[model samples]
Target chain A: MSLREACECISDGDVLAIGGLTIHRKPMSMLHELIRLGRRGLSLLVFGGGPDVDLLIASGMVGSLDAAYVGFEILGFAPNFRSAVERGEIKFTEHTEYSIMAGLQANLLNAEFIPSRLLLGTDVLKSLGYKTFKSPLTGEALVAYPRITPDVALLHVQRCDEYGNAKVDGVLAIDLLLAKSSRRVILTSEKIVSAGEVAGSPFEVNLPSTFVDMVVESPLGAHPTSCYPYYTYDLWHMISYLEYCRRGMVNDYLRKYVAGVESFESYLDLVGEDALSRIMI
Target chain B: MAPWTTDELMIVCMAREVENGDIMAQGLTTPMAIIAYYLAKATHAPEASIMQLAGNIMVYFDEPPQASILYNEYRAMEHAVHIFGQNEVYETIFKRADSIVEFFRPGQIDKFGNTNNSTVKAGRTVRLPGGFGIPDASPLYKKTLIYCPRHERRVFVERVDHVGGLGLNLGGATSGGREIRIISELGVFRVDGRSGGMRLMSLHPGVDVEDVLSNTGFELSIPENIPETPPPTSVDLRLIREKIDPLNIRRLEFLSGDDRLEALQKILDEELRIWRSSNVNRPKAQQML
Candidate 1:
């Protein structure tokens, strides 16, 4: 499927689960397409966040965020998301990274909530309304992290087969859970291979075809963030992104790199081959 | 040798926390924790295993790799002993809760050692990077060590604005131990499991007790006689400077503003020079795995 066509499946107010850890293999191409499509009222579900979540928040499409983190690491706070929350622009429900994972684990098990020892004595219980239930088996009190089932999950990987079997280099993060827990899964990849090739090395296939709904082959799909081995994160671009967000020029960034371009190739052209080459490992 | 910086001193303190055959989980953007684990594995805890949370690779390298923002994971993966998925990372932590010791750099920590890497101002005013796995895992770890690069009233609060991680009380009937030690520029503090209060462990050299008291937002439990925190030995200094982290990337945690950016660029430049000289871009593999 094409990027635009895959994005068209998403509707406004959809619960969207974003794949990848902070500053790693985020689905940048799909996010750009979603921006171009102008989808709004999105409830973003992510375990770890970075510029992608900030950019989506800046796009004014996000209605609420259920996340563990959203930051630029050593650089500073994620400007757009931080300012938006500070100004009461968006409803943000924070969860610890474990809660996010546990929620997904519950969903995978078809359970209402998973009992956990975490979140006890922490303010997350009062803030998020996670109830403390006594386990029937042991009579021990445990925090019940509710299941998280997103409407759609967007992921980017190093490679995928047309049959929807995919492989990722480096960290998988929560992408696998996002794929399994979400109702619909849309994948973007740097390369598309034949089924025979993928089957020959079946052990390498981390994501099976059964879970994938659509696969779009888009090279440089994880630009700015890393796809590892293939390329490292473009730190210079991130530095510029932080500056643009700090100066409240996100629209200009969108124009120059995302919406201004006709396609992903054009976006890459604007980023320049030399710039991309510098990040390639 | 030159006088050791506080960052190096803290790294040595943190490294001392890890025992032999321990599993230290390294989280994202933690250059100091990364080096501390490497230092431990290279020195006393040669059997210590490092679980890279960001890269999802388990390793026990003979020598630590250079710490770079861009290449930390890639370089770690090169020496991968066991490559696993994200779910396994959590499962490993849970299964080995009694043997794991993790380090965190909380945005705000309170008297009871409750941390807040989430939003500040009672989760309303200033937004901080949400606590990744600290809250959940801290309760289950054998020991939780928090290192604050700059110690001040802002960080050492009477009560944190939000509780992203539980402190001294290892809640529930988990097999994990009750141990939370905090190291700051001023000194070291340990939270009492019974009272759930912060107590002065030791003051770093050249730092007065008054300095620590004034900087802390809450009243600290001080003993009758307080000894100075031992300075880094010459061997520890040598290992950190000459072997484990020659680029001094661990200092990044202590830096902020323009100074941080400048330091980061210098490290990146040095990394790029080394990377370019050694790595030959293998032709894109046909199988794509």
Candidate 2:
């Protein structure tokens, strides 16, 4: 299936999850396309936060966010998410920084919930409506975070074939687990090589085509973004978005990037080659 | 122009050293040094070397300046130099500087140079503007200079509520030898070469030794006769009022509650305005020159 068709499958109020943290090989083009298509009311579930989340939230398409550590580094704080929360515009399920990954790990393992030691003597867990369970032996109370299984998992990869056999060079476990756990998986790739290229090296395939429901040929897809080994990140944009979010300008951001674009082509045009050059692997 | 404020005086003292190619780092009260460093380059120290936490030699402009001058490059320039953490620069470069400048409120500092920008004694917790790589960088620098306005016992305590960065221990271990200075509105001080505690080097005019001793929690080592810190010179006052004061950067004091948020927003707005206006017409260079 085409990437757009896979994105089109997403209906309003669906739970969406994307892979990667803060510009390291995120499926950014696919995210931009998803926003350009005007998919709204999304409950975004992710372990860590970055520009992709910022863009989605700023577009006003994200109804709720559940994550940890969402901000641009030195540039500033996460203004969009902060503004949305401040204005009571979006519902949020804030979690301790560790629980986010643990929840995803729990889902990948098919556990009902994951136990965490984070938020002890802190109000974060209780305030987020998570329940605490006491250990049967030690009597130490542990916070249980429910497993998060998104309706769709969008991922960007370094290499893949039309058949959807994907290969990621580094950090395969998280993306692989996310693809396996999600209801549907979408793969955006830097290059669509022949299946024969990776036929002999099956272990190199991060996510086999069988797991990928859709595959999009998006060279430099992580443009104006980072995919480590491939290119350095566009730190300026990340910092700017973070500053904007810190200032509570999520709506303004959405108007400019997501909801503002008339079409996918326009969005692509706005991104320009500068962003594209960064991911030109 | 507005009259020269003491904050500018503090900047002039620090800037003179930075202008001489001395590596400098500062803790939370870095605004004065930040403006001073930049202004010094424009006016006096054109050839001075400056870098940020990431080892990149760029200046950054944020609501609260993050690390060294390099972070400012992100705000001043249009293109981004994609890096991981914001404090990465300070962690790498500022930690190993030849000199550092730290500023604190009266009640926040302890004797060992641990600065508590967070909470006072009570259950009341005041979250600081996040740690800016000081914990790692403090101990490694060759020299550390602390700045404060009010000289009271609460300010010059024997120990701080929290150590923002490492203190005299860093100075003691300096392979090339380190110097630590404490500059305030009232006077200047240096750690006693023998005792490792702060000793009165000089006092500002109108400031008496009793006032200094009374406010300090620890006993101050006094020389026979301490000289007075020179009054702000005409050039110093001119630079402070005309060049730095016009920006009114000091109003960005990090307070708690809504005021903190508002001050942050204003700083951000000001930085963004400066960034946008400066680069609006500048053509993108083929390479970083």
Candidate 3:
């Protein structure tokens, strides 16, 4: 299916849960589509933070972003996120990676909330609006994170078949949980194989066809970000992108590439052939 | 007479804490702890291993991995086992894992060693990056050690405003804090038995006992026989300066020394990228079904 068609499932008020580690396999193609479509007031839940979050916030798409660490590693601060938080443009709340994991885990566990000891005594509970109750059996304090079943989950996978059986190559890095927990799962794949090829693998299929609502073949989808087995993260692009952010011209970048380009293919073209070829591992 | 840079001194003190066969984990932000984690493995604790964030690269360094740690580009990516898509991280590395060492350099740390990397002011809410790990699986780890470069009153506060990480007050198994060790540029501190709070274990060179006392917001325990921090032996200094860290990216740990060091790292990293892509046959990430 086309990315534009896939984006139809997402509405303006939909809460999105993005899958990726820092600079890793994020659903950039669909996120760009969402931004391009000018979807507003998105409440987001993400595990690890990266350029994708920065892009979303800079585009004024995020109403409230719930995440753990949102800064670019070694590339300095997340200028758009920090400035927006300071300007009161986005309501920012912090979650430790584990607590966010617990929030997602609750959905798959078929429970009201996931009980964990991690957030207790930490302001993460109070700030993120978690509840704590005494365990009647042991009389021990337990922190309960409300099950956050996102309106939609956008995931980028290494490969998937026509039947929607998907495989993610690298650190499951909470990608599996993100896939399973959300209400609707949208997958963008670098390669689309036959169901025979998908079913032919010996490894566990982390994201099954049952959970997937849409599969869009978007090659080089996680540009400037690493898609394990496909390419390494584009350090040059990331560095240049941060320089633009530092200048407070994230919008300028969006205009030139993200907003300016007619589509994902055009954006990749603007990224240029040399830049794309260089990052491949 | 030879002297050690504060970075060298802190690294040495931190290295002493790692015992043999201890599994260690430190992210990109904690460069000081990263060096110590590598130094211990290279010098004394050969049996020990380390885990990078996202489980991307698990490697031992005979020398400081300047590009690998700083730019997140090891160039040796193929040799590194990619653990992505494997549900083993949360299952084995975090929750069900055995004893491991968690290293952090928190933005705001209180007297009890509780850490806050969430917000600077409770009202303005200047959001720092949230706490990364340990909060997820704090109990499963054997030891939680802190390494902060700055030793100021604001950092060592009466109490942290937001407890993103646990300390003497909240890290215990009962969902309360257990004893934690803190290694900083100024000195070493451990949870004291008397008050269940942090106390000065030893003072580093050029850092007086009064300097620590004055900087700390809470009263610190003056142990009966407080010893001066053990300076890095000449041999270890040679290894760290000459052998281990060729690029000297470790200097970026200090504020005054950071800008230039980081610039050099970026340049070296760019150059390495060019060289690596041209010469090496970079391995693709294994696609495990």
Candidate 4:
């Protein structure tokens, strides 16, 4: 599939699950592409959350979000998420930071739901309308989080073949689970190679060809971000976003950078070579 | 020190001290105490105000802090408040509090009252709950209080695993000469200005000096004629159960790894026990609980 086909696969109201946390190995260019195409009311479910979710929420495209943690770590908080919640613009169904991951795990296992001990004592689960039931034999109260099966699983991979058999060298578990659980999988890769390149290392092939629905050869695909092994994270942009969030100019940020850009390439132009080069540094 | 029961005795001690208009902060295991402290302020210290990190104002006779209640009243309408992020409502209050009181489990708190809400060793073992901006908040307050239910030697140790937060530097430029107070079920202690060592302040009623000595890991200076903490009253207990418990405002009570079901059940059981024991004969406590 071409880049345009992969971009068009996302429709309205679809739960778009993205890979990576913060700036690490996220499909940012594709995300910007989806935003440029004006994808609205997409409920995003980010596992091990970060800026990808923040950018979506900030763009006013996200209707609902399910994740464990959704803030910029150490640098400060997620200002866009915070401001949105503060303004009552966004509606959130918060789960304990871990339960969000557990829900995805249950989806991979093909289970109906997963029981979690993370939401007890806090009002997070109850606020989400998750019921608590006591096990008859053990007398332990159980919090049942329904399986998270996304409409589409979008990820950026280090390498992939024409058929979409992909390999990600770092952090394989959650992305692999997402690939297995979602109905459709869209991959954006730094390089497109033959199956021969990936066949020698069965252990390193993160996503099998059968599971992939489409593949887009997106070199610098995780540009303005990082796909790990292939590139280091674009921290300068991340730090700039953090500073922008601190100033509470995130809405303006979305309008100018996220919404204003015509395409992912244009978005890359907005980031420019100097900023992108920092990731390499 | 043994866990202090939410009986009449502890309530009275907390009530007399917590005055109106005073910003009170507390840590884990003392959610009830923090609640009781606020209740006493409301009834006795009528001018006292209560602000919670969860974004609720503790009105005198209302339910405990529930996110749903807060969501409906303030969060829902405001729609802009980020509950868990830095620079949220909690950070605003944390910056403004005159007296900031926090509870510390030894494993999580460092020498300067810096807390570690992370896994013990970085990148090695279990990931503990991520730390809030406690380190930034700890050192900024006029007064910092550390409360503990367990008065073990390990808890009262010389240093903590990591400084999740940095308290007012006792001897540093930030100190501004403000001293930190450590309160436990066994006794209350303060950092000695000269040595930075823990020194005895007062003990809870019926607590022994030897027990305090035995449990503390570091050497402490004993003050002569240590005062006993007054017990909670019937009225104080009434306000706590009825008003505070129902809100469910307590954060950090259960360990991150504890079964959610069991932890919640234990909370329910404790609430029931408090109600059954204190409210039958005394109807007012029932109204409050």
Q: Per-residue alpha-carbon lDDT of model 4 for B118-229, expressed as tens digits?
A: 3354344433333333433444555655555556765665554544444433222124565666666676667634545566777777889999888876567787878776
- Compute the lDDT of residue B104 as modeled in candidate 2: 28
Off by over 4 Å in 4: A116-118, A246-248, B1-289
TM-score of 2: 0.51
Better-scoring candidate (DockQ), 3 or 4: 3
Greater lDDT among 1 and 2 belongs to 1
Candidate topping lDDT:
1
> What value does the lDDT take at residue A240 in candidate 4?
72
Q: For residues B144-252, what per-residue lDDT tens digits would candidate 3 score against the true structure?
A: 6788788888788888877777665664332323456788778998863346678888999788888888888787778888889888888778777765665666766
- Whole-model Cα lDDT of every candidate shown, in order: 0.84, 0.58, 0.74, 0.57
DockQ of 1: 0.61
Query: Per-residue error at A105 for model 4, in Å?
Result: 2.7
Higher TM-score: candidate 3 or 4?
Answer: 3
Complex DockQ per candidate: 0.61, 0.05, 0.49, 0.02
RMSD of 1: 2.1
Candidate 3 docking class: medium
lDDT of 3: 0.74
